[model samples]
Target: MESPTEKRPARRKDAEENRARIVAAARAVYASAGFDAPFDAIARHAGVGRATLYRNFPDRYALGAAIVEDDLCELEALAHEHGDRPDAFMKLLSAIVERHTETHALVPALLRGPGEHALQALVPRVTRLLTVPLQRARAAGLVRDDLTLADVIDVLAMLSAVLADDGSGRARDRRMARALELLIHGLVPRAPVGSPIGPNSPRM
Candidate 1:
């Protein structure tokens, strides 16, 4: 009974909602099975036919792009939330490691190249959030003076690779924490060992 113009908008809204649902279902499937997840399974989960799924996503790369966009948005929120703290660099690094461990599938796929442009677009915003805290940490002799923003990005990528290996999560996290501690220690200027100040203190 409605006019075609009014009905067109309603239909478009419905299509958008369906596409969102399909993307969500695809994300869940990928998280469980990575890139090997089948289109049929995703279609079943989305409650759509294979044809409908293809209509929405077109191919694996399209689905991957949608998921990566969601992930980058989440990462951006986290970066904003913790990027200004005195220990922002450490917190930011830890958060990245945790995500690498938990969200194993999405990271590598995004790192492959499809999401690089999106990440590049986000870099200025992310760098603005990180720069002052990182500079302060360097000034405090708490982070490496020679470290560039790109070095921090490389460290994150390496940590993600480490997490992707076939190790237990608990062991991997413990090792990553130790490695980060060592990296931090290496960055700082060490003072000579002073005399013990308390009974509980180790003998110098």
Candidate 2:
């Protein structure tokens, strides 16, 4: 009748470090090889044994959840960091786009898989975190009058459509940069040209 936590011993520092490494490696592997990548592959990438990986994560869904949890914590920090700023919304959106470009929209895709209810729970938390920055953007006229939280969520959904890297790193980066720039211009009152984004831009 004992729970898993009750049965488990205190985690050693090295065990904790290995778990962190596995999760980080899982994220990287998923970005490059898709989420369904083999556990052995993940273990190899982490430089840990398959047994070590399994000890930490029971399955891919668990790994997905861990990645989502990490992302949520990061997002919460970003929202707090941009407190009361008018362009907080834009900055947050840009940061998200950059992350998606790197991770290939894993967070969005994670919502519909196994343990989805727990992942779906993220929606409200994400919404609540974004509410204040969105209000600031609206109040300061940094974004358009019609911009709504729903629109913001929709934008994330759109960005999440990208679930895997196509191995065309340069082309993929250009395409995503174009998409982010377009999304920003659509949300903002004015769109700038030659400000450094999209294809032909040296810096991302």
Candidate 3:
């Protein structure tokens, strides 16, 4: 007979696997059909029963938050990986813009008026993920001395709005690229290295 201990490990493994499948299916369904996509579709996509989907994610908002959390965690890892580079902040920002547009359509579904509080709940975690590379860039004198993390966050919010725009495909992509370039450029220091107005200067 199978011992209880052996049976418990198998059950735990199945539960974890089901949870991962549910999250992955949610990402695909949410990306293609918006957050209002039917949970039944997600369950079918994951090859799981409706019970498993609900077991993993009790509500649509919960599933949406899980997707955002995964994206944020990926962004945080990228920030940490590139944090020591002189252009770390811009690099991080560029990567974020790319990822943001890929999932832009779902933003309204996850963060619109009725769901605003869910977005509010995520702010601190997102901010913490962003601040590290930004501070590193500041310390390296790669950004203007006056730049703050709040400024970075505000710029990102504007970028997300741009991503959510419904213009023609090529035009929208071009505008997003242009907007990101301008944002990065605005953060660059005006003074050349070793100049009187450089980061070391009191006036900086």
Candidate 4:
């Protein structure tokens, strides 16, 4: 069952801190275990009462969504730190891949829950953070001239597909790293060779 969200007032300072702690704890537990890690485990890790944990998050899906929201905030800060560098987009993309390595368990479970919409809603915000970096990259010929933000989004989606097949281990880490390297290589600026992709290009 969902928690009642009607007519709620602002949380107190301690309540806000508790909420943050819960989310951070949930993230760590998820990394060590998976999204199915018990709510009590998260509550204990957060050093909050079960009631406080439930008050802040109704379920694992809510925790997963909250984690994503927190991650996006971190990404916003990271992109700002990169600050118009031509390689900012690549750095941001690499950071995202690393995050997914730790958080892949959330994707399949969140997709099964109502929090999928919450994840979808953040796409626009993510795009906004990515826009400046992508623009800088294209301007500096760091990415292909024809690359669009949508294409980059698609690349991220493809990366998410890799999450489905991974087991949480050193192998998973290496696999994700290699996947990201391959994706970035494809995305890097290419020399114009008279439409080498079309029918006029050499076979094989």
Q: If scored against the real structure, what TM-score would every candidate get?
A: 0.64, 0.78, 0.80, 0.84
Candidate number of the best TM-score: 4
In candidate 1, what residue range of length 10 has the lowest lDDT sum?
195-204
Measured with C-alpha atoms, the lDDT of residue 148 in candidate 4 is 94
Q: After superposition, how far is residue 180 of candidate 2 from its true place, in Å?
A: 1.4
Lowest lDDT 10-residue stretch of candidate 2: 159-168
lDDT of 2 at 74: 86
Query: 1 or 4: which has the higher lDDT?
Result: 4
lDDT of 2 by residue, 164-195 (tens): 53454787888777777777777875435757
Q: lDDT of each prediction vs. the true structure?
A: 0.69, 0.77, 0.78, 0.85
Candidate 3: tens digits of C-alpha lDDT, residues 9-61: 99999998998888888877876787778899999999999988888888887
Error of 1 at 50 (Å): 3.2
**TM-score winner, 1 or 2:** 2
Model 3, backbone clash pairs (residues 3+ apart or across chains), number? 0
Q: Which residue pairs show backbone clashes in model 1?
A: none
lDDT of candidate 2? 0.77
**TM-score of candidate 3 against the unseen true structure:** 0.80
Model 2: lDDT of residue 197: 62
Give the TM-score comparing model 2 with the true structure, all chains together: 0.78
- Kindly list the per-residue Cα lDDT of model 4 for residues 1-204, writing each as its tens digit: 535553244346678899999998998999898777889999999999999999999888888999999888999999989887888988888888888778887877888889899898998999898998999998998888888998998988888887777777888888777787788777877646666666675331
Write down the lDDT that model 4 would get: 0.85
lDDT of 3 at 143: 85
